[model samples]
Target: MSVELWAQPAMMSDPAPEQMMEHILKRVGDIPPLPVVATKILSMVNDPDLEVDDLVSVIQKDQGLTAKILRVSNSAFFGLCRTITTVKEAVVTLGLNNIRNQVIALCARSMLETRAEGYALEAGGLWEHSLGTAFCAERLSSTLGLKGTADQVFVGGLLHDIGKSILSYYVATRFQPILRLVDGEGLTFVEAETQELGFDHAEIGARVALRWNLPEALVDMIAHHHGPSRESKNRTQVCIVHVADAIASMLGLGLGVGGLENRIDDEAIAHLGVDDQVVQDVMVHMSSIGDLRAHIGIN
Candidate 1:
């Protein structure tokens, strides 16, 4: 968790998986806090009786956030008939759910929009990948008649790989061996990580979400996004994000060092009642969305 752990070569010198996981959990304390506004917005969104006025009051506290909301609301992308001049107006025009997605996106941008050398991601690469997955999950939810949970799924997609950020530091130190395993052994990045470091990013990410006190569903999505975890009860949401992550990778939105070394869970697809036709339709829809970065306000 601290630099001291990494200071002693003996500590990492062929440690077992349990030791590696212990180290990861200790480091969770060092993971940065979610932006205050993001935390507030997430709490509001989780509340069943949330009101636009409540969200407006929370957003109003941050002038910069309020401005961003207004700007996006008035942007041509939204195609609003009239200009939005106030937080309340923006909320009304964009709807509380849409605003919630934007808030999560904006808040996550700072943390996710950076290069992760271990993953061979350039600056902003992970952010693009996360955003693409988020959009894909949202679209998939809508297409499958699970619209009620679309927003939650979007957040899950955005955060599915969050553990990668934390693992990057350790990965940087072991990058060469991990890459060797991935390239020469034909192992996926997560597999390489598990082989070389004892734990994978998914497990680390789930712990990070738990440490941040995020929702249980989001935690499951992050933890089991590569596949379904044994403890996952929200199978629909998990499968949605799992398929979404695969779709994003297929699109080459943010491939990182892992490239396309991933598999789409056919069972996950079937679980969501998505057939090949639906997959093709989703691909077409994603292709037509043109400039996903702009649509999601990633720039």
Candidate 2:
């Protein structure tokens, strides 16, 4: 449970990577904490007796967050016929959980909006890819009948690659060594990152999820979206994100330097009790990724 304890050891010949690992772990704390309002909204939604007015009161304290939520609520993203002018109206129209997704989505954007140029993602590329994965994961959970709030998988999918945002600087500085492991030794980008940097983005992402005090399932999803561990308790959620990430990459949402390098694991496919046809259907439905920027309100 110790976030700072990494499994990957630095190369024996190189003391530098150990230093880098220390530096990387220290940097994880520098990333800001999850917004208090967003966390409060998450807590309030879990209360069965929670009322619309209660949720509205918590959100209204932050004028900017409330305004953006209302904007997205009124957009074609929801396909509502009536306009939503107030936070209460948005809660009623979109439902409490949907409104919760908007808050987390925008908060996630603060971290994800950066260029993961280290991963060959520039400007808004990381955000686009993360949003697509979140939507895909949400639909996959529904199609598979996984029991959880819509907010959980959506948040999971959205933040899966968040480590890339934080690790970009290390990746940029150590690009040559990481690349050599991948191209010369045939290591996957993640493996190379772990070997060279002493941790990969997924591990860093797990730390972020833990630091934010996000749900355990979300921590697992972000930690293992690339390849779910066999021992993970939240296997369904973790695998959904793994498959969703692959589907997002396949749809060409945000290939970055990791483009097509990542593949859908057959075990994850089987674990979800789905065949290729279901995968194909999900892919087709997810093609609505075309209007993603509008859905997320990111220009």
Candidate 3:
């Protein structure tokens, strides 16, 4: 959704944070819609009978996106023996799932690239953090023997903090208080947000996903990425993103104001069956990748 959907809170001598959150929710309609191509790709990816040619046709509809797909297909990350010169060839070579993720990343780049000054993130900082989390989540998924869900976990990690983008305006207004709580009271970012704003970014992010008509599994992951949700049916995905976020923060990829203050959910790690060895392997792999921005086309 577009940043325009972030409604300014009403001017009042003393308005409750709950009231402010209600206003924000009502204005969700003002958010920009997802690119039609991205939405179509998401739908097709979930279809059991999706055809490669059908996906190729959809990618071809946008020449720029098609080129991006081909470029990523040939990037050093893929380690292709030859260049992929066409959408059909890229889809066949990279597989539909990888193509779908690339499209999602491209579509989300604009929105995620915005500077979240309220959260103390400089321009492109949030994007860098999100992309790092996407990579980490995908790797974690594979390491946990859930390779089939690597792409889905990547999307979950990519959009985990999206609520911050929407709530940034209000956060800017409440920044001082939030910071005070974080520094003085030793509260986590989510705790501070809930105490000062009557809601956390995770909750807001879930609403955003619902507004976009995203799949329920994705919505749940975005909603509970910080920890497990009793309401979430896909606990594994939620845990994957949760652990991935912790890993990203630990790596200091783009840790803004309260980014480093987050705690790793021990239960989530255990639930995903992630051991110390897995964590070690992920850290080493991340270091070896070097300049993830280039691999993800952020630059």
Best by TM-score: 3
* Residue 130 lDDT in candidate 2: 94
Task: List per-prediction Cα lDDT, in the order shown.
Answer: 0.81, 0.78, 0.81
Q: Candidate 2: list runs displaced more than 4 Å.
A: 1-19, 43-51, 76-82, 147-149, 296-299
TM-score against truth, every candidate: 0.88, 0.87, 0.89
Residue pairs with backbone overlap in model 2: none
Select the stronger candidate by lDDT from 2 and 3: 3
Q: lDDT by residue for model 3 over 1-299, one digit each (tens)?
A: 44724546465655787677667778776767677788777666457678888988888898888777777788877778898889888878877776787889888887787878778887788888898898999999888889867877888888888887888877888888988898899888778878998888889989878878888878988999877865678888888888888889889977987778666688887787888899888888788888876666435
Residue-level lDDT of model 2, residues 1-299, one tens digit each, is: 11112222243344575566566666566557677897776555336677888888988999988888888887876678888899999888777776777787887787777777679897778888899898888778777777464456778889899888877876776799989999999999888988887888898888767777877888898999988888999888889889889888998888898668779888998888977777787787787556776765444
Candidate 3 lDDT: 0.81
Least accurate stretch of 10 residues (summed lDDT) in model 1? 1-10
Model 2: lDDT equals 0.78
Instruction: Name the lDDT value of residue 221 in candidate 1.
Output: 92
